[model samples]
Target: MKTWILPALGTLVCWGFWAFIPKLTTRYISPMSAMVYESMGAMVIGAIVLAVLHFRPDVSGKGIFLALATGMLGMAGGLCFLFAVRSGKVSVVAMFTSLSPLITIALGYLLLNETITLKEGLGILTAFIAIYLFSAS
Candidate 1:
């Protein structure tokens, strides 16, 4: 089996829940409040990982900086998602936000010189079309 399959499936399942649980949360509290509690929940998980790793994680200063920056960007996006879910249909919001991979593809091509094959390019185009159709509903 491919090594990435299990982790990819795990992401699919966890994020399926992740996409859902927040909408449920915003029902009872403000988006900002929900985000606060959400961050706390994530911290608990992080704490467990730290303990499992014996409080030692492989690191470098640049890697640490990049990781922290990633967290900040994720949190910023999460806050935006919270507000979006609060005001928009979660179905549309979730589907639309899920297209974030397009940005990654663009960045990979532009910055990392990753090649997109014809099939992958078609996939990207199809994804954009799907997004338009999905949002129009």
Candidate 2:
């Protein structure tokens, strides 16, 4: 078995739980309130990682800046996701939001000069069709 496959599968399981759990939280409180509690949970994990690393890691100015920016963008998107889960069916909303990989593919192609093969192009087209279907009332 490939090393990456294990971690990738772990990501799939973890993110699946992450998506469903927020739906449960938003049922009881405002999305913003749920996000606050979510941040606390995140902090607990962050603190454990920090302690494991002895509170230090290799650092660079550009890396630090980009990491912070990523956190900000992720938190903003997460809050929007909470709002979406609160208002929409969790299954549909989760499927729609999962198309975020399309954005990553586009950005990688444009900014990182990544190649998209014919198969990938077909997949992208299928994603567009899925988006259309998901958007339908």
Candidate 3:
């Protein structure tokens, strides 16, 4: 098997647990409050990762802009997700958001000039339909 499987599964399990936590927190506390604590914890973990890397990662202008954009976009998604779970069914919200790779796929095709095979296109199409049907209820 590929070497990434273990870490990939770890991510899957971690995110599975992550999607559950907000639902639990929103039961007692506000989603915004939960987001406050969650962002703090994430920053601490991010700091640790930086420390472990000895802060050796790229810091060029292009790199900085890309990294900044990534952090901003991810945090925005997290905030939105917290609110989404608070208002909607967790299963529906989670599954719907999980199909976000569709955005990346479309962007890749448009901006990155990436090729999409007919079969992969069909899969993406199916995912879009699934997300729509899942959310429409």
Query: How far off is residue 6 in model 3, in Å?
Result: 3.1
Q: Write the per-residue lDDT of candidate 2 for residues 1-137, one digit (tens) a residue.
A: 88899999999999999899988988899999988988899889889999999999769999999988998898888999999999898888888999999999999999999999999999999998987798775
Model 1 scores what on Cα lDDT?
Answer: 0.92
Q: Which regions of candidate 1 fall more than 4 Å away from where they truly are? A: none
Clashing pairs in 2: none
Q: What is the clash count for each candidate, in the order shown?
A: 0, 0, 0
Q: Please, what are the lDDT tens digits per residue for candidate 1 over residues 1-137?
A: 99999999999999888887788889999989988998999899999999999999988999999999999998899999999988788988999999999999999999999999999999999998998999998
Which residue pairs in candidate 1 have backbone atoms (N, alpha carbon, C) closer than 3 angstroms, thus clashing?
none
lDDT of 3 by residue, 1-137 (tens): 99999999999999998887888889998977887898899999989999999988766998899989998898888889999999889999899889988889889999999999999989988988988888888
Cα distance off (Å), candidate 2, residue 96: 0.8
Q: In terms of TM-score, how similar is model 2 to the real structure?
A: 0.94
Instruction: Return the top candidate by TM-score.
Output: 1
TM agreement with the true structure for every prediction? 0.97, 0.94, 0.88
Best by lDDT, which number? 1
Q: Which pairs of residues clash in candidate 3, taking residues 3 or more apart in a chain or in different chains? A: none
| True lDDT of residue 73, candidate 1 | 94
For each candidate in turn, give its C-alpha RMSD to the true structure in angstroms.
Answer: 0.8, 1.2, 1.7
Whichever of 1 and 3 has more TM-score, that candidate is 1
